[model samples]
Target: MNKHGIISLGEVIVDLIATDLSNTTFQRLLGGATVNVAVGVSRHGIPSYYLCKLGSDESSEFVKGQLTKEKVDLSFCSYDFNKEICSVYIHLNELGERYFHSYVNETPDEWITAEELDLEPFQKSKLFYFGSGTLFHPIARKTTEQAIHYAREENLKIAFDTNIRLKRWESENQCRETILSFVQKADIVKMTEDELLFLTETDTIETGLEHMAKLEIPYLFVTRGKDGAYAIHKNKIEHVPGIPVNAIDTTGAGDAFMAALLSRFHDNGVPNNEAELTEYTEFANKAGALSATKLGAL
Candidate 1:
């Protein structure tokens, strides 16, 4: 029961990314924000435990095989023959920006429940990381909340990423409320600039901060593509410049950043001072930028 590992709970799906803007040809890969973070952290030499229920299908096997190959621990995962893994078709623009085109989900109701979760991983892990993808479903949302409660009881650091997909939710208000509820319980929160604007209903980061002032999120990272990211800790904001790199695909850059940041925290502990924060964020920015230079997220 090592306390250095990270536990990530969320959906793992197949990503059908268009080879180009033509939208005719696609390359299938195993991807999901939380899944990317698990693999990315594992690559950083940290023990990453992934928690999910996989189905008895080819796509599910592919996802599981990829996770195994990535060196991520699947000891806490489950399997069901009745359910099939989800697939998402993503379209990319000339700038390598991704558009979530469509989703093919057969068993939306089939989610790993809290009762099914093994508490041993929670005891052995140092951090609990998750995203908003699973929160749109009532059953999965209950499971996520239960997991969060377990994480709190274990005194594990909780990190939440607002990997917002508007198409998944019933309404904007529900999305904001559901995400904000989880945000309040997190020790660390990561979001893209667009996600921040959407959640806060504000035009800019400055105004978004004003809207989020009362929530008092301990550490918030708002990433803005090549412009780098703004790291807000204890009311002090520092702009960490993005590392320069030849752009390719921006699929899982934020997940890369989150994984790097969490890996740094796992190794050296969370940065408490400005100097430490800068060094940690700079390291993460480099990882994120490097990830964008690749085609697939994994």
Candidate 2:
């Protein structure tokens, strides 16, 4: 949390990815869009700071342990006395796709409100990253809002991933409205083709990028499973091919892609040409593919 590193503000939860919890053993992994990205960035050899509140609980310790194993900076992370784990169960379909089921009402990640958290880490960051997961709760939303404001004021690039967790929100309207609010604050917005349709209420990726463009966001990245990805910036568009992988679970592939892209951006400015964009996109595509080979998010 010192300075001059990437800062990720969002939830870090425990994900129990299992095809059948009753019959088979469930795999435990530290999951959550922001947390996954934080680990992804660190694994990419970037100085990444993961800012989230942990509880004085074993599950929280597991999250910290995962981050520590990845060598992520935890200077801005806090601990809550009344800590509880954000547990989620994931089911896989015939195609290896995942569906999440969560009964947890809350987690300690929301305890770090804007007023309580130290903004110095965010201020010193060259880029700030988040996702829609943080907006599920009011306390976490306030913290995310403050970080966005600070990132914009400092002219630091803001990276966002629209990770819609239906289990976390009470209503779709509430979720959609909050997602738009954060989208307006992001400099670069990353999401899936399906997420683009759901979040922006658009049928096509072009329309989603168009909506982001009108919001003054300079860049947009859309990852389309096996179809690869599309990138639009400054009215320029490019479609990058996807990498083929026998994916077992795509739990955090998109987050990994976001991390790879942000890591590239942190080291070098935005790609200025089709070639550069293609190279960057391919790099991110590999990162995402690598993630799918694993069971959990991070």
lDDT of each: 0.90, 0.80
lDDT score, residue 270, model 2? 80
Model 2: what TM-score? 0.89
Name the regions of candidate 2 deviating beyond 4 angstroms: 1-3, 17-25, 91-101, 106-110
- Give the best candidate by TM-score: 1
TM-score, one value per model: 0.93, 0.89
Worst 10 residues of 1 by lDDT: 209-218
Q: Per-residue lDDT for 123-211 in model 1, tens only?
A: 99899999999899998898999999999999999999999988899999999999999999999999999999999999988999777
TM-score of 1: 0.93
Clashing pairs for predicted structure model 1, backbone only: none
Give residue 198's lDDT in candidate 1 (0 to 100). Answer: 90
In candidate 2, residue 96 scores what lDDT?
61
RMSD of each: 2.3, 2.9
